[model samples]
Target: MAEGAFIRDVASFEGREVEIRGWVYNSRSSGRIHFLILRDGTGFMQAVAVQGQLPDRAFQAAGFAPQEAAVVARGLVRADRRAPGGYELELRDLEVLQGSPGYPLTLKEHGVEFLMDHRHLWIRSPRQHALLRVRAELIAACRDFLDSDGFTLVDAPILTPAAAEGTTTLFEIRYFDRSAYLTQSGQLYNEAAAMAFGKVYCYGPTFRAEKSKTRRHLIEFWMIEPEMAYCDLEQCLEVEERMVSAVVARVVERRRPELAVLGRDVSKLEKIRPPFPRISYDEAVEMLQRAGHSIKWGDDFGAPDESYISQQFDLPVFVLRYPAACKAFYMQPDPARPEVVLGADLLAPEGYGEIIGGGQRIHDLELLQARIREHGLNEANYGWYLDLRRYGSVPHSGFGLGIERTLAWMAGLEHIREAIPFPRLLHRIYP
Candidate 1:
């Protein structure tokens, strides 16, 4: 290894010899010139190997290096307008550590199932790389928004005594002799944290055991739940719009290349500013019915339903005030309309579907207790949760923005599975 230069730091070594360790992503050559494309995870760069200029060992290694083979390129960095990442490696020497034989993935079209089955290897592709980068930026931007806004980070348990959303879609676990379940949402714990810290958020993995095969559903996924004490429904919506806009701005500014790689229309993201359009559930239902759907008053929105409503707006639209019976047990019912809860679901534009669901929480102990019992959940299990209302309850509000769903919408990806590095679906879980 010469001079120990990483591909990302090659600009500093311009006109000077340096070493690059990476895997061969691609290769092409005429009889006289060989172009070797390499990626070191941080970035991709091209290394040129010409005939008669290299020693037999170096020339032979570069000429026949298979895709995915491990190699080290000793070269001088040079600026290239046409090369990837705006730089090229002039190979003076080449070393192949290990050769990959008959790599399965080639430059051909593969079905989604086949690609997903080979996802462990398919991540090497440019689109997959871009998706991963956008996902990272989304997470970073979310944490930045919350942390800079004076929101404390609180860790939520993966295992819980009772489900946050409901028990129907919970994955129950046998904990020694007692029964526990994987957390469906971090909302409840974020609530308790908000009461203690004034404002708090939880960013972690959440599980949903529903047997959904929709493009937007994932059995295991990540969520960013921001809960604020003394915040009303309107303030919560403001926080949501701000957080989402910031995250989208980060992706658009820092990840333009990644977005281009995914073929995302930058204009759509450029329109993602604050003061997003808001409509009521009644309006959404009317819109859905007008769109030729037979949706009733109390029914929730489905994928097609959300798609129709979202297509009406260019920015992420918030549909507020769902029927109390259709919402979670802890959602606060609107004082003016006892039948509808003061909740909201942010549906992304262009049929990306609902990426956020949240609302003001019920702070009254008796009301929460009645809701719990009405929902047929065990009261004894919610004693600790009830204690929050009993001890010092404030009108707190929060919302969870699904990381993968949001990433899919931001990157203009077709499937939500591509948003995460290693996706866990209802039936598929492997390498």
Candidate 2:
């Protein structure tokens, strides 16, 4: 048996015979020459098989193997600018491990629902492969930036007794004799972790039971929430800008090939630097009103409003100091303007909205208690959370960056569903 190699590393094996084990991406035949495209998850490469060089059976296998057929091919690698990944293989032998003829997905156009129903198989396509690879790179970039910036990773519980964002979007479940809900946000727990470790982060899947079906909304999504003790809203904004810029830079540097595969405009991503444009909620509302939107000052922004605001700037824009009544109860109210809270929502450019949402949290025990009462939350369930304030609460700030939304923005995906491998949307829960 020849030495085995992955399609991604085939460039290093030029002129050397190696065995590639993967699924057949595509195949075509022209007279005596058969071209086979193979994908091994790492990347895609083309293998050319000549009828006279290989045995008749092997040539037939190469020519007849259908899409996604499991196959092992031995070939000598060569540089070919015309081929995928700028490399191709001169096939010496081909063996079909398992024939996958009559595959449901083909080169023909497919409806979104049909494609989604066959998502288990749809991910095998080159475009989906590129999306997944970019998603992985973005996730790694996020963790690397946080880990290097003195932020400790702390795990938050997936199941909790109370709502963190709001009671309206809680997924209730039975916890033995009592009831529990899937966590909407880990911010409340991260607050406690920040108090202990000074700077901490929690990265995991969070659930929101929203009923509306929008291209930007996912019922289950991943989030990276970072909390910093003794950090105010301004400091938090600084960290947000730096982290966002760093993550985008890393993706641009390392995942260029994947981004190219997705047809993303790298020049747009290259412009994501520090000191993003910041405007207050009042200014945003004024701009929206001037632009003929029917939004008022105290009302929260909808998808259309956010899209309009984001489109006004080239970089991610921060809309700060939203009305306290529209934001979460934990947000610290601005001292000078009691009606608005010291919170910020970082909206992504080109119509992707609110990738990051966070701000300085209320640290005073009395004020927190009052907010809890005002929100009509059960105080008994939050006694442990209240203990953090009673012990040693300091002014702190943090934010949650939705991984799917951020990846969608970075990858230039039209729907947020493609950012995740197996998306859980309002009505989607299959393969």
Candidate 3:
């Protein structure tokens, strides 16, 4: 009947009696002594029940409770170096609210498919819990960095009348009596907002219809896009490196325990600072050729190419000025070399490619209209977009940072699927 306490805060209440309401993570018994590992969402704690320390029924309940059984445990919090989270509870009473006998998941290893099938329950596992916690920390860090850097949060529409990236990767959906598609990126809308607010960002889910089974692709993912009104490519890159460094520093400082749970190499993350190495498209292609890749000048970098390029640097590397032919139509062409656009992709180190893609946008109405027509896109659908340039378009720059890919790289996850909760992939969309 003591005041309820979460395991995460039990350290401050050492020696005080409190009731922990949660599910039994694991249980074991050795004669009269019962050990119950309880997880109350915030953290895990080992609750010990001695036969004579409490009523017979309470001790029996502690011993017999199955894994994941809902329960309330009244106990005195104690410090124990060997226990999980460095805290233990001496149980005075135990009440099993629901017996979860024969839980579907066990201590044994399950196949990826089987685990994916049970992802709803699998997230309760410690590893999944840690990954999700780190993800939350990363998201918060990104928002904090952006907000503190004079960026206003402006929301963009999920249903769009046209594609922001390309038409091929759009997920078309029928609106009432017409057609609409899920948004690929919020960069366009963010540009409009930047004109109004000077500096703005839109954070939301984006959908892509790529049928990729690679470790980096997701059907639905979150993007953090920031646009600045009078920024150029160089200024954009400067903002990007600073924001990335700040976010990485925050995760390293506050999410150390979670990162440790994921077995992340914090040393590399600690080295993520400003002034990341920048290479021109020509330079990157030369490096690839020297490394024996068969890619040509205008070809976009694949996962392998990006990985190879990123691995050459200690910090995230910026590959700048991609060929205008392969980049988005809105990218501003370089004045000295009109063949390339003033855009860049920030490739994460250790083979996590292209976490952030952005660049200076075309502010000339005539050029933008020409580029749209050249790309075989309908100018009618983009009249409003061109109007931004028609009115008073200043030099603007922005980028979209894919949350899943960044988290996967930071957490050292093997697949992007684990970076998100309820991942919607090309083939799987179940619970």
Candidate 4:
């Protein structure tokens, strides 16, 4: 028995016998020869078996093997220009480890609903596999950029006593007879950590009980929130753009084949370097009106409005300084314009919508208390948050970037659901 090798590394064993253990992705048998396609999560390869060369049982196993059937094949690895990984297996012996008959999915096109229902199986498909590969790369790029920049990771709690955004969109739960809510964002806790570590970030899953069933929305998602002490709105924008550029470049470089599998234009991603176009909220409103969108100042722009604005740029666009009423209470009020906050939303191009949202946080104790009361939130729940501003708060800024949304944009996916492995939508939560 030859030592086993993955299909990806099978080329190294050329002209030598090796064992490959994987599930049969597909198989086709003629009268004298059979071709077996094998997938082991790493990659796929082809195995060939000739009737006269292998035992009768080996030929029988190869001829009638079912899709997803676990199998092991001892074969001589050979170079094949026509194979998936530029290598093929010449089977000398074969054994069916577990015959998986009647697999649910096929190599044909399936409806979105049907595929989503079988998401676990659907992920094995080429497109899903590629999409998720890029997603993993983007996450690594994010951590790489932040860690290399001297930011300490400070994890945020999932169960929080207070809402980071608002109560209306919170998922309420009972924790030992007391009401608690799933965290909407980790920006607030990152603020405290920033004071301790000077630069900090929180990367974890966050919950939003929003009833929105839009393609761009998810019930539960992962966000990366980075906070920096002595950072202002402009500086936050620079940091955000740099991070976005780094992640995009990484996905483009490492996941080029994956991007191509998803039909994404590499040129669009290559133009995603830093120095993305910037426009004030007022300017965005004006641009929207000129573009025939029925939006006005002080009103938050909807998907249609955002799509129109983002389409004006080749890369991500920064829309900054939104009206205070439309933003979270923790955002710092603009020193020059008290009615607006030093906030920003980074809208991805190609109509993918907002992928990041953040701003300078309020650092004055009195202002923080007033904003909390103004927003009609309970004061007792925010005592710890307010204490940060009371003791010694510097002008700090941060933002929350949704992992799924960013993945969708990078992979050119039609919906955010495909970006995450097991997505939680407003109406579906199983599997």
Candidate 5:
């Protein structure tokens, strides 16, 4: 137990003696020789203790009955190609710290319900560990992209008095004297900040009370949104492409090992580079109809339609300028065709639909007020928002990127639950 020695540092102590105190992952005894795989939170190491060659105390301590028993070992590190990590340890001393009884998750199959119930322990598994590592990389890549692009990171209020989008999916929480809802999107507040900072973004968790049972929906999820002042929908799409491309590039560069663990082909991610193909809502409807999908214009694309349209392109494709009636109240109407909104959805390839939803917002106070009234929303609730337009408003656009969905696609996970450590689904929310 040297002052500066960690379990991972054992590789540097190769061919020399060292001590690693950790829990046993598993152990196999073959009468004459014992092999124990130990993990100390930093890395895993294999320890070998031979009978008649070591003291009786060492052999007894290494003879773990159950897999997860805790023990400390003093051994000599040696390089061996037969070992998984190319390093092996010959034990000199052993101490049992804690004795573990029968474990639930063994080297066998379990039902999805059982696994979800034990998600607290399931994250320690190799697959989840690899998935979380990739998630960390994705978050870092997002921050890196926003920071490098001159976008200031601004945190929005979680508890709000009124809904910015609508009251349909609001998660109401009892406040001191009134009811408050979790912020669904930070776009409205980010728009106010954009007037001051020119470009601003918010990255945090959003909540919805709707009972959705789809692979693409989460009751609570993280969103990364960027708002640009004086920028139109075209400029917003350009930034979106660059930001997403930068994130994909970082994952490719840093998480090659993690991706390999999840059995993902890195080339699928490498195709996420610049100039993602763009198509209009009208074109998408036509393509879907041609592809045997019966989706007509003026209808929001469903999951099946999204998958069909996304399948046509190798990388993520942008479906822009949807019918204005289907969009949120904040979307700006197309000047040429007032029936279409200046919005876009970035649909990921491989059937990962709608990772990003964003568009230009109405800058004129009159138009915003008219849209609000037409949508049957209370004008009093949005008085402060309309003030942004009354004072000095410029064309601004932004988008929200769902973190869990993006991570699921990036990690090639079969389900979105695998991406989140503790998922809050419609039917279950525990541990």
Candidate 6:
């Protein structure tokens, strides 16, 4: 019986015979000599076989078919500088475990729709592997940063009785004769946990039923929500900058090989550090207007406006104190300018817009109630939430960062869809 080993572990088995099980990523034949590239999840390695050197059946099997065909190859590991991993397997035996029938995804270029339609197979590609590797590192970086800062990991509910933010974007379903909606953000729930834990965060999937199809929007995406019990908007922005910088630094440090594979410019990522540029909403609008943009004062900045503003700074631009009319009912109004809310949008460099949206929540019961009424929202739906304010609620602030959007920015990917494995978009939803 052959001892199963991973393709990445083949290096440790140099000059020793080992059995590697994997799907054939690609293969080539040269009359008497054959080369098979195997991918076993961890990584890939090449296996070389000679026609006369192996059994007749093995040689016949080596001449076989398409990419990603499952197979097990028994071979002796040998070091070669020319090979991908500085090593190659000299195949002594080969057998197909399972064969794929005319795989559609080839090494050649594929259309975006075609690739997305075949996402199950697309993840096996070098680019997708690189993106996923970066995603893992980014996630780990986020968790590590929060953990180091004395933040507890608290998981909130995915199915809830009522919507936390707004109902329009929620995906509701019937739950035991009552109505339930998939959570859009865990901020409100995490706020309750924060009162107990002081500082806590929730990282998980959040759903939104957005009807538009944009490069930055996703029907289902992961969000990282960090809530602090006694934090204000300024402190919140500080934590946000530090967390983002830590994630970028860790990704650059640990995933250099993967970044190189993706052809990302690491220098840009290396420049990400603390003290990101900050501007008030009024100032940002002024700057936009100075730059010949026709952006009005109160409206939420569109994609192009965000891109233009972000282009002015090397790091993310923290746009703060947006108009109260445009912000959510929960955001606290700026004391100096009563018309503006103490909310912010963290815009990533190079046109990646609004990776983080957060604010100082209205912790006062009367103010919250008034805002809810002012916004024409159903105050009855938020009775329990209002109770938090009535009973010892302290000043709090938090933010929700869409994981796929952040990953897309960090991985230097063109489309946000490429950052997630099984992306759910408006027009496309399938395997």
All-Cα superposition RMSD per candidate: 1.4, 1.1, 1.0, 1.2, 1.8, 1.5
Tens digits of per-residue lDDT, candidate 2, 1-431, equal 67999887887888899999998988889969999889888888899999888888999888889888999999888898988678898888999989757899997899999999999999998889889988898899999999999999999999998898665588999999999999989999999999899999999999989896999989999999999999999999999999999999999999998899899999999999989999999999999999999998889898899999999989999999999999888999999999999999999999898899999999999999999999998888789889989999899999999999999999999999899999998888997
- What lDDT does each candidate get? 0.90, 0.92, 0.92, 0.90, 0.87, 0.88
Model 4 C-alpha lDDT per residue in residues 282-378, reported as the tens digit of each score: 9999998988888889999998999888888899999999999998888999999999999999999998879999889999999989999999998
**lDDT (tens digit, per residue) of candidate 3 on 59-123:** 98888899999999998998988777788999999999997689989979999999999999999
Q: Candidate 5: how many backbone clashes?
A: 0
What are the TM-scores, per candidate, against the unseen true structure? Answer: 0.97, 0.98, 0.98, 0.98, 0.95, 0.96
Q: Is candidate 1 or candidate 5 better by lDDT?
A: 1
lDDT of 6 by residue, 147-214 (tens): 99999999999998887876458998999998999998888888888888989999999988979688
Error of 2 at 89 (Å): 1.3
lDDT of 1 by residue, 248-355 (tens): 998899999889888999999998999999999999999888889989999988888999888999999999999998899999999999999999999999988799
Q: Flag the better candidate by lDDT, 2 or 6.
A: 2
After aligning candidate 6 to the native by TM-score, how far in Å is the CA of 55 from where it should be?
Answer: 2.5
Distance from true location, Cα of 302 in model 5, Å: 0.9
Q: Give the 10-residue window scoring lowest on summed lDDT in candidate 2.
A: 161-170
Which residue runs of candidate 3 sit more than 4 Å off their true CA positions?
Answer: none
lDDT of 2: 0.92
Model 4 steric clash pairs: none
